[model samples]
Every structure is written in C-alpha cells, then in structure tokens.
Target: MHQDTVEKIEHALEGWPLLDSLPRECYGFHYRALCVPIDDRYDIFSYENAVIHKSVTAYYHEETHEYKLRMQVGFVEFCRIEYITNSLEIFGEKLSKELMQLLEDMVTFNPKNISSLVIKKGICDWAFAKELPETLEGYQLFIKPQQPVKINNGSYIIIDYVDFTHASDVTIYYNMYRDEFFGEARIHSIPDVTYDFDSNELVELQEKLEKHLVPRMREARQAADAAAHEGEA
Candidate 1:
C-alpha cells in the first residue's frame, strides 16, 4: 500500500477506540498489483479478543482507480456480518459505529431479549442459529457444532461453550420417551449426569452449566480419584 493510502486509512479510523487499542502486531499491509501473487493484493487489519474477531481489508483496483474495503465482525467460528463498500470513509465510520453498538449490546444482553421459540429453534438447528444466544451467553457462540446425530431413539446436537477462560462443550438432546430436553457436559471419563429441562428452562440450563458445571466436574473427578486410590490400596 502506498503512503497516501495508509494515511487515508489512519485518518478514517481515527477515534475508533477498539481498533486503536489493538496491538500493532494485529495490523498488516500488503502491496502488489492485482495480477501479482494472490497473497499480496490487499491490506488487512485484524484483531481477536475473547468474545469476537474483527477484520478490515482494502483492495485497490488499478484499472478503475477504485478501492474496495471489506469489514467483518463476528464470534470466533460462528455468525458474522460482512460489509463491503467502495468508500474508505464509509468503511471506517460504519464499522466503528457498528462495533461500538455491538460492544454496548454485549454488556446489556439477556436471555429475556429472545423468544422461547427462537431459543428452541436455535438449539434444534444450531448449525444455522448460532447467534441467538449471544445475549444470554455474553459471547459469540461461533464454533460450529456437528449436525444432529441420531442415537438409539433420539437425536443430539453438540455446540461449543467458550469464554475468556474455559471451553466446555455441551450437548443438547431430545428424549423420545420422556419428551424432555436433556443437556450434559462432553467430558471424558466423567460419570454420566444429564440435566432435564423444558423449552422454558433452556436459558436456565445454560446458566447452570456456565456457573456450576466446571466445579461439579472437578468434584466428580476428585471422588473418582479417591475411589481409584482405595481400589489400589
């Protein structure tokens, strides 16, 4: 990228605190002709935090003297919004405004903001409705889960639960006989413990897992270890 273009981007991004606060290593620039190597065609700026990842890229078309700016924001491995514009000013201003709003929403999000139907549908079709619980979870649940897999008499969908400090995978399933929603931690070698919930208890189950699952798993593991030591003795 030319010095002039760099200056324009810096000016456009002025007053954007989120991007500005990112370390210098997160910023990258590539300069080459449109026909050159595929990797050197655009200048990219990217940043990733616990909850979201954001990126902005600029591609200049020499033939038309036009600049294409692409901005994207989303949770890691989940839902995202991509905005492309030819105006550098719009790219900077729009992305900054939208990001600020997103940050505000994150702080104020709650499960009550979403409908019960939406929650049920999101869990049933997690591959498609990954963003429905962002408010309740306070982070982007972008990690794609496998399609619902059939078991003996029911089906289950697994989705990722991630935060700044933990990654606890969860499986949501339906019991054909019981007609209930069941959730369990996807831990290895742990005793089987499944919580049954109704559609209304969906958010409550998530809250329980987020707050207590880890500690519960720890206690279970300790008990198992003690039992094993006794057997050895």
Candidate 2:
C-alpha cells in the first residue's frame, strides 16, 4: 500500500503471534504465521496466495531428503522454517533500508505456501462447509467425490478472500505428525463450503471441534516458535 502502512504492518508482525494462533507442523517445519488473505471470501480457490511483504524470492528444497515443505498460508504461514536457510534475499524492497531490515531479520518472506494433502473424513473442510452449489452467483457448480470440485476456476470460483463478506472462521491452523522430528499426519486447509444443515447437533459438534482446533494448532506453533528461539540463540 503505502510506505507508512507497510512499515506499520511489519512492526506489528514483530509481535504478531502467528504460532500462538495457528500451530501445525510439516516436514522439518517449526513456526506459525499471521497473514492477510488476498480476499475476504470464506471459501477461496487457491486465491492469489501472496503474503503482504516485500522480500527476496528463491527456490528452496531439501537436497538429501525429498521431504516436501508444506507452506500453509492464510491467517498463518507455516512450513519448516529451516528450509529457507539458504533460500532468500531482498534487494527489491522499495521501503527504506532501516524499515526493511526489521522484516528481513524477522522472516524469510515466502508466500507460496504449497500443500499436497486433501481434506480427510473426520476433520472439517472449511471449503465444504461454505459450498453453495447450483445457486451461487457468478460461480460454477460441480459434483465430485470431494466438495467444491472446481475443475476450472470460474468467475466466482476464483477464491479471493479480499472481496468476500465472510472470512474463514478457522484460524491458527497446523498439521500433526507422528514423529517428534518429522511430519506424518497432514491436516488440509480447504476453503469454506456452504451447506444447508438439517442437524443443529451436528453443526454444534463441528463448531465445537473447529473452535478447539485453533488452540491445538497454536500449541504446535508455539512449540515451533520455541524451537526456533533455541536454534536462533
């Protein structure tokens, strides 16, 4: 936006509890993120996944291991923070040097959060909950094994959260893995789906679970942040 606005966001991010809000683990990842969804739509299809930051960009992948770094970004961005160890630089920031340096020192600034997991059965997919089929304006309707099955991005299928009336209720998202040092179980982030529920009890349960989910994610994010603190020290 503006230089002053950019500076404010960067400064606030310094104390922004990304992990405290959404904590999950992936690969060798260890951090949580607070971010802006490009759009405000409750269910966005791979919305222009960009973070609000000006930083360096580079290719990052593990050399010896084929482990995939899952960069889940929306409210929070999480992935193996270590993966960016040698993968970034920032010479393009238009902001003055002093302000840019704070962000440069704080984050690696990669907004391309990629994931491979699909929503599983027990957990709630925000996408499925917000799915409004056959009647949604400016969007295509489709049926498939999964909810919100968009084979092609539509005029409405364009998942941009910046323009919507509803923002996703799920925050502080994180993934659970089996081993302490490795990730095995992946929690997927699907856009919210609109559903006409006949069961209030079911909706209540889902809402309860969803409410509880963020804190659990936060725990992991906190752990990740603590570990980061140790390593950085």
Candidate 3:
C-alpha cells in the first residue's frame, strides 16, 4: 500500500501486453467469480450497495474493454446464504497484470464492510493447434492441469493438483477445457477464498503468477502445439 510499492507495481506492469476483456481469439486466461456480501442492516436497494454495483459496470468499461456481465443480487434472510453475482470474464489477460487492480477496485467501490469474499469460480482458457491427446499421460503434460471432467470429446483436460495460495486464502482449480471446435486450450481455476484485499496480498498473488502460473502456461502451450503436430502426421 505504500506509494513506493504502488509505483513499483506500475513500473513492472509496463512490460505486460494489454489484456482484452473479450478477445476474439482467446488464448489462456483466468478470472474471478467474487461473492461479496453487504452488512446485515443494509437493504438490497441501499445507496451504498447500489453505487458499488454501478461502479462494477463502469470500471470494466473504463479500465478494460467492454464486455457483458451478469448481475444477480437479491434481498434474503440474514441467516441464509447471500449471493451478489459479480464475475469477470477474462479472455486473454495475464493474471499478474490484471488481477490485483481488479481486486483493489472491487474493494474501493464497495466501501461498506464486506462480510465475506468467496471465489465462486476461476476460469482460464488456452488454445492449441490440434486436439488434445486421448491418453492420460497427455493430460498429465498440461501446464498445471486440474482434475479431468468426464466428457467424450478432447475439448479439455484438468491439472493434476489444486494450487492453493495461502496469501489470498484461495484454493485454485486449474482445468484445461479444450475446445477442439475452436482449436483452443483453457485453464479454469475455481478458488475458494476469504476476501481480504491488501497490498501484501496483491504482491503475493503477483509473485505466484510470475513464478509458477505464467511459466506453466507457456510450457503447456508449447507442449500442446508439439503434440498436435505429431498427431497431424
């Protein structure tokens, strides 16, 4: 949160390719489905929550590219589970470059004390030249694939393990959803976390992406391309 740290982040971001919210050709990407709750006394139509909701729309347009969002928030009993549907669909954004600012903005707009922050789902997409392999070892070769979904087609594969980030307190599920029809490879991460956005956490997430996630994505892409070529022959 220090000015110096903020400045450092800004400088580091200069090298990153700008992420299009809705890229026509989506490569590999990940996004958050945030569950933010208002205080018990707050009404669904309260001015603060309304403004926060509005800001969510405005920020996506002003900061990033224009994309459609699904907004679902309703009045409910205090004891029941509350749903404030706010999710970002990231087409080709690098995690380290975009995620921190997105979280900061979410916290800033909704100034009211948030009761909880749960990552409902995290999605990542990676594209390849040919279809993914039918074998288990081929599935194992994916960058950081998650668990496999039972499906007939080669549209996807899941990473072997769930990546847990203690800093953000989110469990990340990295799955590769292969779209043979579109020739794309996707990594979908569903993280469960307690929402606490701070500068330290931001730095920690960035480090995780740069150190682990990004490299794996690159490697996955390369490996997928090679396998696809081999299949062609």
Best by TM-score: 1
Q: Tell me the tens digit of each residue's lDDT in model 1 across 135-210.
A: 2332234333323322333433334333322332334454444544565543333324555333334466556555
lDDT of 2: 0.27
| Ranking of predictions according to lDDT | 1, 2, 3
How would you encode candidate 2's per-residue C-alpha lDDT over 83-127 as one tens digit per residue? 223311221121123222333332442222212232322223444
Q: Count the backbone clashes (under 3 Å) in each candidate.
A: 2, 30, 18
Question: Per-residue lDDT of 1-233 in model 3, one digit per residue for the tens?
Answer: 23443344345334424322322221122233222222311111111233222121111221222222222111100110112112222311433254344434333433232111111122122222122332231232222222222112222222222111111111122222321111122322212222221112223433443355434444444554665578689
Off by more than 4 A, model 2:
1-72, 79-82, 86-174, 178-205, 209-233
lDDT scores for all predictions?
Answer: 0.41, 0.27, 0.26
lDDT of 3 at 64: 25
Instruction: Report how far off residue 109 is in candidate 3 (Å).
Output: 15
Model 3 global lDDT (CA atoms, 0 to 1): 0.26
Candidate 1 matches the true fold with a TM-score of: 0.30
TM-score of each: 0.30, 0.21, 0.20
